[model samples]
Target: MESTTTKPDEAATEKPVVTRRLDRVFLELYNVAAFVSRFFKEVLMPPYEGKEIIRQFFEVGYKSLGLISLTGFITGIVFTNQSRPSLAEFGATSWLPSLIAIAIVRALAPLVTALIASGKVGSNIGAELGSMKVTEQIDAMEVSATNPYKFLVVSRVLATTFAIPTLTMYTIFVAMVGAFINVNANEATSFPAFIEQFFGAITYLDVFSSVIKSFVFGFTIGMVGCYKGYHSSKGTEGVGKAANSSVVTSMFLVFIEELLALQIVAALRAV
Candidate 1:
């Protein structure tokens, strides 16, 4: 019953490496950068896709809230347990809530949440876009008169821009709450004094800078993930590569941003 078609394995599976390197790495990065630039260019233009942006906002931001909260809870409890003994040795077990709040609010919670978010949302963005590219959906959108880049990239990027700071805010709040549980685990600390001391450590300046840095972190994460996914090649293998690369890149960027932000925070403190 076989027709006279060549066996599937008879076709060469290997591509000439040099010919593909431009597409595989260099052009891919260029294309991603270009796509992000184009997104910003068109995002403020007329005929805004408000509804789609909202949907993306919910999907990207609100959906990730629970994971952030759960992680915050665990981080608060474990961090306090581990650090309390040292502070207790100094007879400063009383400083537990104050210390935890400053660290969590200013740095730890936001940075760790972003790291986890990259693993979750960044990979999801990459795989989703890579799959769409593989399935010809982006091409089909173009044929249907849709600006696929605007329709796809802008909404998602904007969502990350807005949602991540919201998540950071939430993470800070939940971490303090969980730390309260830790404070009570040994002996109840005065809730009012604890609250006041925690808030004392948080200057408006610190809050403003921390929040702004988180937004930048979110934007970078979204851009990298969406860029890789939207330009994925070679079907399933390419999609997998895009997802892996997105998480790796986002995690690296998160840490770099943390270092930069900490330096800025220090400088601001000295002023």
Candidate 2:
């Protein structure tokens, strides 16, 4: 018989908790993937949200023009100014146009535009949807037999998907203009000379890759924002959390997409 009191092993006790947390993360990821899949499926189904999509497109694209343009111009100026000293040291000042154009077209413009939109559009969507959820507007729509998901989620997502590429293109043009002005201020480079070399360095492949990446970035931002908002809970606190999470998640997704896009671009170039 005897005194058989067993002590609990801390390691063994913690293992299950850690495993459950990991499982929860995996489950959340799966749920998000499923939500995105549902969005695509719903998008293709009846009662297309043409009008709402157009409206949201204007909201996401036109409303964002000023911010994007200002940031793009500033980016160009700062980038050129920073690189000039290095280029001058290496007797590569003449390469400025090509470098600026290539960087803007291939990476900077799209990345900056997407990030701005994620900050602006992502937060707006998340907060708007979260508020609607909290106020029961979404539920009321369902009660009235209106397809709220289509009107709210699909439209916004599609608008962002289409608008971001347009914004990226606009950003590239504006950034180039900024670089051109900055170049002239620093050197004897003429507008024509700058434009010639700028366009010369940029290949069709670069433009295509940037456009594709923008599309993906836009989709990711819109979907994540909507997902966060749609699932928001905990009353008003949830709305704030949703908005914050949307920006963070969207930015993270943008970087991930950029990395994958770069790999794809490299693979395509090799082919």
Candidate 3:
């Protein structure tokens, strides 16, 4: 009968495999923290890459406008349509504008905008940087006395950080417009009345919290994309992986941040 005991070599190798994986996980976390710290450091002390940042802004924001607009409009219409029956059942149809406004302004707008940006902008940054990494272009930039990190990572990150909030504001406006269309059709609610209810339902705190959440979400998306792409390996395969992982990671982080932000906002509101 074969021995039931594990061979010494097999046992030794098994332990190391588990240990190595654990070590790799922690090492990856450490590297990410360092990368984030470096970004804050370099971003503040800069021969600022103004042109690159502007170019990235155009890439991230302007190019994404059509998709964002369409998504926001659709979301508003769908949400309003879905909400109407519930309100109507209670004879509270008049509250549709305020309900939509609060729901969109306080939650839906920021979340939808961030998720869209995470897919579009995050994947683009990851693919772009991953390609640069694999092609040795980044190395060449370093050899040519350029700070590649500043020129590439910082600029893209800054672009996302700023562009996303602006996009969120646009999303809110577009979504509100869409919701108004649905409301108008159902109740003949005047646009002016809808607009008044929309603004009246939202407070300074709601706006402030949404903006803060957008900023955090933007930063998380940008940083995750940059980190994944910057450290990518294995040539073209790695570039694809980087882009895919950037989207996945950014979306995950956005959800986590959203949850945390809501908790913090709740706490603040309670005060």
List TM-score per model, in order. 0.88, 0.92, 0.94
Off by over 4 Å in 3: 1-15
Counting clashing residue pairs in each candidate, in order, gives 0, 0, 0
Better of 1 and 3 by TM-score: 3
Model 1, poorest ten-residue lDDT window? 8-17
Span of 10 residues, lowest total lDDT, candidate 2: 5-14
Model 3 score (lDDT): 0.93
- Candidate 2 lDDT over residue span 177-207, tens digit each: 8998999988879988998999999899999
The numbered model that scores best in TM-score is 3
Encode model 3's per-residue lDDT on 1-271: one tens digit a residue.
9998877666456676788789789999999999999999999996999999999899989999999999999999999999999988999999999999999988999999999999999998899899999999999999999999999999989999998989999999999999999999989999899999999999999999999889888888889999999999968999999999999999999998888988998999999
Q: By TM-score, highest first, what's the ranking?
A: 3, 2, 1
Q: Model 2 lDDT vs. the true structure? A: 0.94
Candidate 1, 182-266: lDDT as tens digits:
8876858767877887887677876887789889888988888998898788679999999999999999989998899889888
Instruction: Quickly count the clashes in candidate 2.
Output: 0
- Which residue ranges in model 1 land beyond 4 Å of their true spot? 1-29
